[model samples]
Target: MNSFLSNAKRSCGEFLSSFKISQSTILHMVLGNNSCDLDSCVSAIVLAWFRSQMKNGNEVYVPVVNIERKQFRTRTEIAYLLDHLNIDSRNIICIDEANVRELSNVGKGFFHLTLVDHHVLLKSIEYLQTYVKEIIDHRPQLIELPSRIKCNISLVGSCSTLVAEEMLKNKAFSVPSVVETLLLATILIDTSNLSVDVGKSTPRDEAVVKQLSGKRTKDELNLLFRSVADAKFSVSGLTTEEIILKDPKWIENSLETIMMSTLHLDVREFFAREDSIDVIRNYCATHNLLAWVALAPVINQFKPIALYCEDDEVREKIIEKLIVSDLLLVKTSDEDHARSDVKFLRMYNCKNTRKQVLPLINEVLQQRSSNLSA
Candidate 1:
């Protein structure tokens, strides 16, 4: 790992060593989004490292992964990339391990927060909204923020591009080759290696890649992108539960929550797992998941979506909503789901990502809640 990151890592370790509610020290942290994907993780870690290197004042900087500590290992691409960079994952702060709640409860002034990869705060941590000092995200601005907060929301392939620009603006050129390469990797992943066909890559993303990928051949970066992308989908060692939580997207609303887990393996293989139903139920019960969106990409060419719900009535309502939408959902039963409590559906819609699916599902959940309240 680079010396800057190494020092930041040590600082994080030292901070945790004596963390307490009564402690006088203030923490300035870069917090990734709750989803904690590769882009979010990289943005948080690298940006924190950059800030600490600047040493603006007596501030103590830390990068926080916005997930449970255990969930860290399940994020394969993140684990793999950090390991490749020689960064010790143990040194990083995961939310479950952080004293964020204790600190937040102490007061909003106790800590300063900079949100990366996402603008809106998760409901669980919305209590810290007043402390949000800055935001760097690629998504369009979702809501208004206090004039005191510095918000940099724009359309781009990855927030990494924004961070990379920040680095470049402030002579992050002195940043290690490894860190720059890592940022390059994130941009590639998010923009599908700047693939025109993917169309996720913005001109800004391409410009950043060109600047950072000096001397590195196109073929080499392509190989690296493929390797990381494959690692992202390889659920080799994860258990059934981990598989579900690996890239799980928790959709929350006023009265409902749903989990949409994206998997790269065949839907049949996931269905074949011995404890699939049990794990699904456990995950649902914990979150009161009104529905489960099992989105598995088969052979990287087809997408099979399965919606699971224990309540047959709720399941039918969700099915009705999905079937009527543009998702082109076709209920399929390759296995014997006839006797299972959790209903399943197989829809082959590759073009529509969670960006489209989540809102549709949320509408169903919201409408259902409204009906129940009525």
Candidate 2:
């Protein structure tokens, strides 16, 4: 056997021995196709830990969610790791069964199942409540899983990072350099390179990033950031609507629409030249959109100042009510925040800001419902 494979096998044996679980019954369910950076990270970390414990004859199954094609990368990496260890790829299972009845009947034996996922599975939760062995995830709902099943959930960048830390803590195995780099790259990609707009990058993610990069230079971090940014869908090929849908937050139904305008500026460019407020005003007019808001990051303060138009009349009212000198009217267009927006919204309760803007969204929704009824 090659040195790498040999080392991997040895680590697997050591991990299994430490756990005291019978090798034949431990089945790993690697949750694939996570949209959020944190979910993907957790998936990778847990899979790596499981890889270390897998014996030659042991069976490990990776199930892909049918709905999330974007999560294919996690499964692909797991396959590669298995191949490197000289394990057959056939053992990996792609789960297509949409219902729990089918999943529960797949196989029977001395089995301990581990599931890592972000989606809410009400049926699966009930099933797991009765029979699940363990689950590691970032979702808050998983807290209700029976105590008999081990559960780990955190609101951090990625679950993979958490899993990696746990493995290291238990002295399971040293993170291979390639694996370390991959994990760090995922974090930077997901967290937008620790942009302050995203929630503050956790110390764990920072430590891992530094370790992977081997040096803390701006140039190196920038290169990694560029690499991840490139992975995003190209602007030319996708419509603004498609791009907005790609946001993980959008998937949760918290937002009705998003509008954004970009401005390029040089050192000499004045805030007036940016015309961000005016551009937003024009967008609102053209689209006849309500509940429109604009966010510009104040990098020094690490907070996003959201400027929104209440309904046209309301905007006028608010401007009049507050007697604000600077007020701009605009239509709603659809655009989303890059990485920093994810962090900013979550960190600053940007969603709750809707309480003030709710009137517009409600008005829009009501109008739509009326139109449909007509």
For model 1, the run of ten residues with the poorest summed lDDT: 330-339
Provide the TM-score for each candidate, comma-separated. 0.87, 0.49
What RMSD, rounded to one decimal, does every model reach?
3.2, 11.6
Clashes of 1: 0
Best-performing candidate as measured by lDDT: 1
Cα lDDT tens digits for candidate 1, 328-348? 555555555333655555565
The alpha-carbon lDDT assigned to residue 314 of candidate 1 equals 71
lDDT computed for candidate 1? 0.79
Each prediction's whole-model lDDT (CA) = 0.79, 0.42
Q: Assess candidate 1 and give its TM-score to the true structure.
A: 0.87
